[model samples]
Target: KADAKARSSIMLKAEAVSRYPSPAAPLAYGTAGFRARAELLEGVFYRMGMLAALRSRALGGLAVGLMVTASHNPERDNGVKLIDTDGGMLAVSWEKHASELANAPVEQLNQVIASIVVAEKCDAASVGTVLLGRDTRPHSEKLSAIALEGVGALGAAGRDLGLLSTPQLHHLVRMTNGEKGAGPYVGDTAAWNSEQGYYTMLADAFSALLSSGGDRASCSPLWADAAHGVGAPKLEALLSKTPQLQVAVANTVGTGPLNDGCGAEHVQKARLPPRGYEAPLAGRDRAASLDGDADRIVYHYWTKDGSWRLLDGDKICALFVGFIAEQLDALALEPPISLAAVQTAYANGASGRFVKSLGVPVAMAKTGVKYLHHVALENELSVYFEANGHGTVLFSDRATSALLAAKAEAEGASDEARALAAGRLLLVRQLVNQAIGDALSDLLLVEAILALRGWGAAEWDGLYEDLPSRQSKLPVKDRTAITTTPTEERLTSPLALQSALDSLMAECPHGRCFVRPSGTEDVVRVYAEAATQADADALALRTAQATWELAGGVGEKPTGAAA
Candidate 1:
């Protein structure tokens, strides 16, 4: 009876919304989910809701999450990424199903859903739930409504978390699913499921970390660029609770164009502070930029010589690895805890060598957060980051248990050893977001580390110098022809392409080059690094031209920077 009712409701809702014309171009579920012009995402959003309902039903009603965001993209663009019960990206296997459902013609929509139902063996009678959240994008509200309508049609329950960061939504999904059937604290589950809980948890953790460390007053105030996105107000709320650290926020106007010449992407690409980001911060004061969705962060600061220095993902990983390794060494447990940092080919060679110099192992994974996250899981303590600033720290169960045990044992030790062990362990678990890369969480972690080490951005930047590098995108008739090795450090297709690149690289000091298809865009990304900026740029252009010639490029040969 329940199954029949759900089917009826679903059909009615689908029938009403299904009348909207399908897009001329089929939607492909990319690494970032269905992202495009906001005007074209209504159908995709509706179908994603249905898929989320099915996913919830498949998991026996554990809450799934739907985040409406385009991350670093401009405000005109919008996207949706499904969150699994574990608060991670949707399983790789289901991406195909999502693509099929999203692009299915209206006439065949029901057939597509039926196919998925038969294949996954989802019980229609089972209850389904979806937790929905959106960034501050203008189109988010209408798109969210369309999603909710789809959920209703499926007869699934949903809670609209009015406005939230991507990480906040992930945190809620994990807390909701993890806390199920487990008795809750603070009156009920609602307390933990709200944004209040999210802010409180991070605030409390930050407070604990600050209290456990040396004088916090000596820390310099940070200049933060919120990219005029949702993170600004949320960050303000967060800082209110933990007042030890002061931050001056920029580009926080809600009505402003998101990621418009600002945000992590801008900071990283331009290697400078965002436009309109003057905060009177200079000398020792640090600065950071959060993407439109606040899932990634990149740090920079003005030096005494008046040059802006960037501390990218690679540097962040080094700092984290060094700190964690020091803590573990102090603990000196019987069963050793292995610490490793994960990076992509985009990582600067200097960063890799720096991490190795600290006696920490480094692993290279293909581009994308899911791939990095998976490889990070192999180590007891994994710190993964992309050069573009998307990443997080993961602590295995063994590492968490060992840390707790060490902290307990330290309670009876000398004051110096006890403070080192307990404080470091607690701070590690509290400072890093295990679920995903969170700009706010990472920002706090960076601040805490700077304060503890008594080092300014200059000192940290002095750890290593990034080799001159250039990245260019070449449009090809078929980007799929450009296949790569597992680590994306070498090209496996376009026979002899790697050889040509190697020859060019051999001519330049410290030169390296690689080509891979962009997962999120329709271009072949060519990366080259060398001893000098001019060589790097020239090598990148040559490599891109070679790839274009080999991979069926669409137009005339690319030249100069466009190459």
Candidate 2:
């Protein structure tokens, strides 16, 4: 703890010195930042210090910090991002400067930094402070040293809160920056943020559902794979509410995260139960894995005999949409509150139809949460989901007002009337719960719905789930060279993109196909939702092949970045 404090002090001092240095260029922010290629750690850090200094000045001399080093990304991939005063991502527009800083040449970068100092009326030698934090990856420590050097060179204080989870760093950043009170505390759990109001909302809704359904017997257990990121610490706060809810957590300890062996990206293999073919358990044990950031989930459930049945992101969305719709019907609610499920082009066709069948509206958006967040915010959507397991629901003031007004109409209503009204509201709450897109949250939702309907896991998702859907990541060498440069220019031209989409349309019922360059990796992901597993696989592979062919081996080049 003392060592940590000392490092923090050093970083603080370093930050103050670097205030006057010009930033490299503007940093672009996507849902996450355009991840810094792994080999570019030095470049990212130098740029991060500049960006942090700029933000500090922007916020009226508040000390800002940089979380440099990609959490859970590959060894060759690194990221530099800032946690806001409230511990959430900064506004998208703010990242624009960071992107600029990243793209600027060294000479111009120094000038830009100098200019920022002039603009802020601060001496080039006396900028504000910056804090530095890193995780457990082997590269992380070395990266920290280099970043600290940069920060120190700029006369900014660089603190090393060595070996903390990403979220813990987030919390510390908030508190140290005056967003929260000083803890003066150290150790694993002390630094965890208590502002997990979002997760709490989901739990409260789930608890209400279980209570209403007469399934208040006992809270459910949570078996989670945190993927050794920030998830475990944040989830700990959530589990605190329902003490009866047992938690069997794995992969909770580690420095490096987000590898192939852990998280939602890892496929769970089916296990055969003991006692040969006549074993009481016929299928394999099932589990869910969360990615490094803990925002994504991929589910694995067991069959009657114990065989494993994997549930992807789209299926998870479908189950919630369908369940919520029926619950509303039971309460005699009409039009079902105009619920909207926002999906990406990659979502499975059956899942899309299933959501629509539940009497809810659907909107399709470009890949990634940036666009989805905008659409949800603008449209006042009741819910939004992504097939990649990244989603959030909008509890818009308008929607809440509508719900409250409806409740007022139910005042003095009989027990039956109250139940009906409650059911309708519960349906909306369920939509929010599922829309969190966190796997454990999804599991809780599924279990609650099952209890209400008296259905088992298999029966809960409704009719046979249509057909086989398959997704695979195909390498596109030098995908960047084929598209654009300086990172931001990589966007595919509309004409080219539309042409590809048109060709993919031919694979229908065979499944919908789309090409997505990974936000954090080099490979492009191809997804297909078909009427048959074979068809889905073939179509997805073919489309992927076609996309690469069109790119003329652009994606096949060695970008040397980590996923």
Top model number, TM-score: 1
User: Which regions in candidate 1 have their CA more than 4 angstroms from the true location?
Assistant: 1-16, 179-192, 278-284, 413-419
| lDDT (0 to 1) per candidate | 0.82, 0.54
TM-score for predicted model 2 compared with the true structure: 0.70
Candidate 1, residue 543: Cα displacement in angstroms equals 1.4
Candidate 2 local lDDT, 374-488, one digit each (tens): 5665553345667656654555545555555555655546546545554546444432432223444555665565556665446644543745656666566654533322222
Model 1: per-residue lDDT, tens digit, 1-563? 54455455445544535545456689888678889999998888888888998888777788899999999999999999999887788988889999998888888887777667666666666778999999999899999988887777677898898889999998888778764522221122455566787777777777776666656424678888899998898899888877878888888957479999889998887665786554335432788889999999999877666676788888898888888888878877788888899999999998999999989999999998988998998998899999999998888778776777777777756546755765676666756676789998888888877777778888888888999888888888888888999999998898688888889899989999999999988888989899898988899998988887778877789888546
Against the hidden reference, what TM-scores do the models get? 0.94, 0.70
lDDT of 1: 0.82
